[model samples]
Target: MLPVDTTQLLKGVLDLAVLAVLRDEDGYGYDILRRLRTSGLTEVGDASVYGTLRRLFNAGLLSTYVVPSVEGPHRKYYALNAAGRGELQRSGKIWQDFASTMDDLLRERETA
Candidate 1:
Protein backbone atom coordinates (compact mmCIF):
# COMPACT_ATOMS: atom_id res chain seq x y z
CA MET A 1 0.00 0.00 0.00
CA LEU A 2 1.09 3.55 -0.61
CA PRO A 3 1.47 6.23 2.00
CA VAL A 4 -1.69 8.19 2.78
CA ASP A 5 -1.97 11.77 1.70
CA THR A 6 -2.18 13.57 5.00
CA THR A 7 -3.59 16.59 3.25
CA GLN A 8 -6.59 14.55 2.16
CA LEU A 9 -6.73 12.91 5.54
CA LEU A 10 -6.91 16.28 7.23
CA LYS A 11 -10.38 16.84 5.82
CA GLY A 12 -11.79 14.48 8.42
CA VAL A 13 -10.49 16.71 11.18
CA LEU A 14 -11.14 20.16 9.72
CA ASP A 15 -13.91 20.79 12.25
CA LEU A 16 -11.51 20.14 15.09
CA ALA A 17 -8.95 22.43 13.51
CA VAL A 18 -11.51 25.19 13.21
CA LEU A 19 -12.54 24.72 16.82
CA ALA A 20 -8.89 24.85 17.87
CA VAL A 21 -8.38 28.06 15.93
CA LEU A 22 -11.41 29.69 17.51
CA ARG A 23 -9.98 28.63 20.84
CA ASP A 24 -7.15 31.11 20.29
CA GLU A 25 -9.36 34.19 20.07
CA ASP A 26 -12.51 35.62 18.62
CA GLY A 27 -11.87 36.29 14.90
CA TYR A 28 -13.63 37.20 11.70
CA GLY A 29 -14.15 35.03 8.62
CA TYR A 30 -11.17 36.24 6.66
CA ASP A 31 -8.95 36.21 9.72
CA ILE A 32 -9.84 32.60 10.39
CA LEU A 33 -9.18 31.75 6.74
CA ARG A 34 -5.78 33.42 6.85
CA ARG A 35 -4.84 31.80 10.14
CA LEU A 36 -5.71 28.32 8.86
CA ARG A 37 -3.70 28.94 5.71
CA THR A 38 -0.73 30.16 7.70
CA SER A 39 -0.86 27.05 9.84
CA GLY A 40 0.10 24.95 6.74
CA LEU A 41 -3.40 23.88 5.71
CA THR A 42 -3.06 25.19 2.19
CA GLU A 43 -5.97 23.12 0.89
CA VAL A 44 -8.54 24.84 3.07
CA GLY A 45 -10.95 27.09 1.21
CA ASP A 46 -12.63 30.24 2.44
CA ALA A 47 -16.11 29.00 1.62
CA SER A 48 -15.42 25.76 3.43
CA VAL A 49 -14.36 27.69 6.50
CA TYR A 50 -17.39 29.92 6.27
CA GLY A 51 -19.69 26.96 5.94
CA THR A 52 -18.07 25.32 8.91
CA LEU A 53 -18.57 28.51 10.87
CA ARG A 54 -22.23 28.56 10.02
CA ARG A 55 -22.68 24.93 10.92
CA LEU A 56 -20.89 25.34 14.20
CA PHE A 57 -22.93 28.39 15.01
CA ASN A 58 -26.14 26.53 14.23
CA ALA A 59 -25.02 23.73 16.50
CA GLY A 60 -24.50 26.20 19.35
CA LEU A 61 -20.78 25.53 19.51
CA LEU A 62 -19.90 29.04 18.42
CA SER A 63 -21.31 32.47 19.04
CA THR A 64 -21.01 35.30 16.55
CA TYR A 65 -20.69 39.01 17.13
CA VAL A 66 -20.47 41.90 14.74
CA VAL A 67 -17.36 44.07 14.98
CA PRO A 68 -16.87 47.29 13.08
CA SER A 69 -13.50 47.86 11.46
CA VAL A 70 -12.65 51.10 9.74
CA GLU A 71 -10.74 49.38 6.98
CA GLY A 72 -13.67 47.31 5.79
CA PRO A 73 -17.27 46.31 6.41
CA HIS A 74 -18.47 45.12 9.77
CA ARG A 75 -17.12 41.66 10.38
CA LYS A 76 -18.99 38.80 11.98
CA TYR A 77 -16.57 37.32 14.46
CA TYR A 78 -16.79 33.86 15.96
CA ALA A 79 -15.97 32.93 19.53
CA LEU A 80 -16.00 29.57 21.20
CA ASN A 81 -18.59 29.22 23.94
CA ALA A 82 -18.56 26.97 26.98
CA ALA A 83 -20.17 24.19 24.96
CA GLY A 84 -17.59 24.55 22.24
CA ARG A 85 -14.72 24.53 24.73
CA GLY A 86 -15.98 21.36 26.27
CA GLU A 87 -16.49 19.75 22.88
CA LEU A 88 -12.98 20.71 21.86
CA GLN A 89 -11.52 19.18 24.96
CA ARG A 90 -13.36 15.92 24.31
CA SER A 91 -12.49 15.82 20.63
CA GLY A 92 -8.87 16.70 21.30
CA LYS A 93 -8.47 13.70 23.56
CA ILE A 94 -10.16 11.40 21.07
CA TRP A 95 -7.96 12.68 18.25
CA GLN A 96 -4.86 12.07 20.31
CA ASP A 97 -5.86 8.50 20.93
CA PHE A 98 -6.65 7.88 17.26
CA ALA A 99 -3.39 9.48 16.17
CA SER A 100 -1.44 7.34 18.58
CA THR A 101 -3.06 4.24 17.16
CA MET A 102 -2.26 5.28 13.61
CA ASP A 103 1.33 6.01 14.55
CA ASP A 104 1.73 2.59 16.03
CA LEU A 105 0.27 0.88 12.97
CA LEU A 106 2.45 2.87 10.58
CA ARG A 107 5.59 2.23 12.61
CA GLU A 108 4.89 -1.48 12.69
CA ARG A 109 4.42 -1.55 8.93
CA GLU A 110 7.66 0.35 8.41
CA THR A 111 9.55 -2.22 10.43
CA ALA A 112 7.86 -5.09 8.62
Candidate 2:
Protein backbone atom coordinates (compact mmCIF):
# COMPACT_ATOMS: atom_id res chain seq x y z
CA MET A 1 0.00 0.00 0.00
CA LEU A 2 1.07 3.53 -0.63
CA PRO A 3 1.59 6.01 2.14
CA VAL A 4 -1.09 8.70 2.46
CA ASP A 5 -0.07 12.23 1.56
CA THR A 6 -1.11 14.24 4.63
CA THR A 7 -0.56 17.49 2.81
CA GLN A 8 -3.13 16.49 0.22
CA LEU A 9 -5.55 15.56 2.95
CA LEU A 10 -4.89 18.86 4.71
CA LYS A 11 -5.75 20.74 1.54
CA GLY A 12 -9.12 19.01 1.34
CA VAL A 13 -9.98 20.05 4.90
CA LEU A 14 -8.05 23.26 5.45
CA ASP A 15 -11.10 25.49 5.33
CA LEU A 16 -12.97 23.30 7.76
CA ALA A 17 -9.99 23.13 10.08
CA VAL A 18 -9.54 26.87 10.02
CA LEU A 19 -13.17 27.44 10.82
CA ALA A 20 -13.05 24.96 13.64
CA VAL A 21 -10.13 26.73 15.24
CA LEU A 22 -11.78 30.10 14.99
CA ARG A 23 -14.90 28.76 16.63
CA ASP A 24 -13.57 29.45 20.10
CA GLU A 25 -11.76 32.75 19.65
CA ASP A 26 -10.66 35.21 17.02
CA GLY A 27 -7.04 35.15 15.88
CA TYR A 28 -4.65 36.72 13.40
CA GLY A 29 -3.26 34.89 10.38
CA TYR A 30 -0.06 33.62 11.94
CA ASP A 31 -1.81 32.82 15.20
CA ILE A 32 -4.40 30.76 13.41
CA LEU A 33 -1.64 28.85 11.61
CA ARG A 34 0.05 28.19 14.91
CA ARG A 35 -3.17 26.89 16.41
CA LEU A 36 -3.54 24.38 13.59
CA ARG A 37 0.03 23.17 14.02
CA THR A 38 -0.41 22.89 17.77
CA SER A 39 -3.57 20.90 17.21
CA GLY A 40 -1.54 18.18 15.39
CA LEU A 41 -1.82 19.59 11.88
CA THR A 42 1.87 20.37 11.64
CA GLU A 43 1.68 19.80 7.89
CA VAL A 44 -0.38 23.01 7.47
CA GLY A 45 1.52 25.80 5.79
CA ASP A 46 1.52 29.52 6.57
CA ALA A 47 0.46 30.58 3.09
CA SER A 48 -2.37 28.08 3.12
CA VAL A 49 -3.74 29.33 6.44
CA TYR A 50 -3.44 32.98 5.44
CA GLY A 51 -5.07 32.28 2.13
CA THR A 52 -7.85 30.40 3.82
CA LEU A 53 -8.49 33.35 6.15
CA ARG A 54 -8.64 35.72 3.22
CA ARG A 55 -10.96 33.45 1.28
CA LEU A 56 -13.21 32.95 4.25
CA PHE A 57 -13.41 36.67 4.90
CA ASN A 58 -14.16 37.37 1.27
CA ALA A 59 -16.88 34.76 1.28
CA GLY A 60 -18.78 36.80 3.94
CA LEU A 61 -18.22 34.10 6.50
CA LEU A 62 -15.68 35.98 8.59
CA SER A 63 -15.14 39.45 10.02
CA THR A 64 -11.80 41.12 10.54
CA TYR A 65 -10.44 43.78 12.88
CA VAL A 66 -7.08 45.36 13.42
CA VAL A 67 -5.40 45.32 16.82
CA PRO A 68 -2.38 47.44 17.65
CA SER A 69 0.54 45.46 18.92
CA VAL A 70 2.99 46.87 21.45
CA GLU A 71 5.99 45.05 20.03
CA GLY A 72 5.55 44.88 16.29
CA PRO A 73 2.97 45.83 13.68
CA HIS A 74 -0.78 45.88 14.01
CA ARG A 75 -2.43 42.49 13.78
CA LYS A 76 -5.57 41.81 11.80
CA TYR A 77 -7.80 39.33 13.56
CA TYR A 78 -10.50 37.16 12.01
CA ALA A 79 -13.69 36.12 13.69
CA LEU A 80 -16.59 33.99 12.61
CA ASN A 81 -19.86 35.77 11.93
CA ALA A 82 -23.35 34.32 11.86
CA ALA A 83 -22.80 32.90 8.41
CA GLY A 84 -19.50 31.47 9.42
CA ARG A 85 -20.94 29.82 12.49
CA GLY A 86 -23.67 28.29 10.38
CA GLU A 87 -21.14 27.04 7.85
CA LEU A 88 -19.03 25.56 10.62
CA GLN A 89 -21.95 23.65 12.08
CA ARG A 90 -23.09 22.35 8.71
CA SER A 91 -19.61 21.41 7.58
CA GLY A 92 -18.86 19.77 10.91
CA LYS A 93 -21.84 17.50 10.55
CA ILE A 94 -20.82 16.55 7.03
CA TRP A 95 -17.30 15.79 8.19
CA GLN A 96 -18.53 13.69 11.08
CA ASP A 97 -20.76 11.63 8.78
CA PHE A 98 -18.00 11.11 6.23
CA ALA A 99 -15.51 10.18 8.91
CA SER A 100 -17.90 7.70 10.42
CA THR A 101 -18.43 6.03 7.04
CA MET A 102 -14.71 5.76 6.43
CA ASP A 103 -14.18 4.30 9.89
CA ASP A 104 -16.82 1.67 9.27
CA LEU A 105 -15.25 0.73 5.97
CA LEU A 106 -11.80 0.38 7.51
CA ARG A 107 -13.16 -1.67 10.37
CA GLU A 108 -14.89 -4.03 7.96
CA ARG A 109 -11.68 -4.51 6.02
CA GLU A 110 -9.82 -5.23 9.24
CA THR A 111 -12.36 -7.87 10.24
CA ALA A 112 -12.37 -9.48 6.80
Candidate 3:
Protein backbone atom coordinates (compact mmCIF):
# COMPACT_ATOMS: atom_id res chain seq x y z
CA MET A 1 0.00 0.00 0.00
CA LEU A 2 1.13 3.53 -0.66
CA PRO A 3 2.13 5.68 2.28
CA VAL A 4 -0.66 7.90 3.54
CA ASP A 5 0.04 11.58 3.74
CA THR A 6 -0.73 12.50 7.33
CA THR A 7 -1.91 15.94 6.27
CA GLN A 8 -4.62 14.34 4.20
CA LEU A 9 -5.58 12.08 7.07
CA LEU A 10 -5.75 15.05 9.39
CA LYS A 11 -8.25 16.87 7.18
CA GLY A 12 -10.84 14.15 7.60
CA VAL A 13 -10.45 13.99 11.37
CA LEU A 14 -9.71 17.58 12.30
CA ASP A 15 -13.29 18.36 13.13
CA LEU A 16 -13.53 15.44 15.46
CA ALA A 17 -10.26 16.36 17.15
CA VAL A 18 -11.48 19.87 17.68
CA LEU A 19 -14.70 18.56 19.08
CA ALA A 20 -12.68 16.31 21.37
CA VAL A 21 -10.84 19.30 22.75
CA LEU A 22 -14.01 21.29 23.30
CA ARG A 23 -15.66 18.28 24.83
CA ASP A 24 -13.44 18.66 27.87
CA GLU A 25 -13.36 22.44 28.15
CA ASP A 26 -13.75 25.70 26.29
CA GLY A 27 -10.72 27.16 24.49
CA TYR A 28 -9.64 29.95 22.20
CA GLY A 29 -8.18 29.59 18.69
CA TYR A 30 -4.51 29.53 19.65
CA ASP A 31 -5.16 27.46 22.73
CA ILE A 32 -6.84 24.79 20.64
CA LEU A 33 -3.89 24.77 18.23
CA ARG A 34 -1.46 24.45 21.12
CA ARG A 35 -3.43 21.58 22.61
CA LEU A 36 -3.42 19.73 19.31
CA ARG A 37 0.35 20.18 19.06
CA THR A 38 0.90 19.01 22.63
CA SER A 39 -1.09 15.85 21.91
CA GLY A 40 1.47 15.03 19.12
CA LEU A 41 -0.70 16.24 16.25
CA THR A 42 2.20 18.36 15.03
CA GLU A 43 0.97 18.40 11.44
CA VAL A 44 -2.12 20.46 12.35
CA GLY A 45 -1.84 24.10 11.29
CA ASP A 46 -3.04 27.13 13.20
CA ALA A 47 -5.14 28.60 10.42
CA SER A 48 -6.71 25.30 9.58
CA VAL A 49 -7.72 24.82 13.19
CA TYR A 50 -8.99 28.35 13.48
CA GLY A 51 -10.94 27.98 10.28
CA THR A 52 -12.48 24.77 11.54
CA LEU A 53 -13.53 26.58 14.70
CA ARG A 54 -15.37 29.20 12.68
CA ARG A 55 -16.91 26.59 10.43
CA LEU A 56 -18.09 24.50 13.34
CA PHE A 57 -19.58 27.57 14.95
CA ASN A 58 -21.38 28.41 11.74
CA ALA A 59 -22.72 24.89 11.48
CA GLY A 60 -24.17 25.30 14.98
CA LEU A 61 -22.09 22.45 16.31
CA LEU A 62 -20.12 24.75 18.61
CA SER A 63 -20.89 27.87 20.60
CA THR A 64 -18.56 30.74 21.28
CA TYR A 65 -18.00 33.45 23.88
CA VAL A 66 -15.33 36.01 24.70
CA VAL A 67 -13.19 35.91 27.83
CA PRO A 68 -10.37 38.07 29.08
CA SER A 69 -6.94 36.53 28.85
CA VAL A 70 -3.82 37.48 30.74
CA GLU A 71 -1.35 37.52 27.86
CA GLY A 72 -3.19 38.49 24.70
CA PRO A 73 -6.48 40.18 23.85
CA HIS A 74 -9.81 39.02 25.22
CA ARG A 75 -10.09 35.85 23.21
CA LYS A 76 -13.04 34.03 21.69
CA TYR A 77 -13.48 30.76 23.49
CA TYR A 78 -15.31 27.77 22.01
CA ALA A 79 -17.31 25.09 23.74
CA LEU A 80 -19.56 22.25 22.72
CA ASN A 81 -23.24 22.99 22.82
CA ALA A 82 -25.76 20.16 23.06
CA ALA A 83 -25.39 19.43 19.37
CA GLY A 84 -21.62 19.66 19.56
CA ARG A 85 -21.49 17.27 22.47
CA GLY A 86 -23.73 14.88 20.58
CA GLU A 87 -21.43 15.04 17.58
CA LEU A 88 -18.40 14.38 19.77
CA GLN A 89 -19.99 11.35 21.41
CA ARG A 90 -21.04 9.91 18.08
CA SER A 91 -17.70 10.60 16.43
CA GLY A 92 -15.78 9.14 19.33
CA LYS A 93 -17.67 5.88 18.99
CA ILE A 94 -17.16 5.82 15.24
CA TRP A 95 -13.42 6.37 15.63
CA GLN A 96 -13.17 3.64 18.26
CA ASP A 97 -14.86 1.18 15.93
CA PHE A 98 -12.78 2.24 12.95
CA ALA A 99 -9.56 1.86 14.91
CA SER A 100 -10.53 -1.61 16.01
CA THR A 101 -11.30 -2.69 12.45
CA MET A 102 -8.11 -1.17 11.06
CA ASP A 103 -6.06 -2.85 13.75
CA ASP A 104 -7.46 -6.19 12.65
CA LEU A 105 -6.84 -5.45 8.97
CA LEU A 106 -3.20 -4.46 9.60
CA ARG A 107 -2.28 -7.40 11.81
CA GLU A 108 0.19 -10.07 10.64
CA ARG A 109 -1.16 -13.32 9.31
CA GLU A 110 -0.85 -16.30 11.62
CA THR A 111 1.39 -19.22 10.77
CA ALA A 112 -0.83 -22.18 11.64
**Best-matching candidate per lDDT:** 2
lDDT of 3 by residue, 1-112 (tens): 9998999999989999999988888998989999998998999998899999999999999988999879978988898999999988999999999989887777744422
Give stretches of model 1 more than 4 Å off.
1-7
TM accuracy, model 1: 0.91
Each prediction's whole-model lDDT (CA):
0.91, 0.95, 0.91
TM-score, one value per model: 0.91, 0.98, 0.90
Q: Distance (Å) between predicted and true CA of 15, model 2? A: 0.4
Q: Which of candidates 2 and 3 reaches a greater TM-score?
A: 2
Q: Which regions in candidate 2 have their CA more than 4 angstroms from the true location?
A: none
lDDT of 1 by residue, 1-112 (tens): 9997876777788889999999979999889989988999888978889988898899999999998879978999999999999989999999999999999999999999
Candidate 1's displacement at residue 95, Å, is 0.7
User: lDDT per residue, candidate 2, 38-84, as tens digits?
Assistant: 99999898889999999999999999999999999999999999999
State residue 13's C-alpha deviation in candidate 2, in Å. 0.6
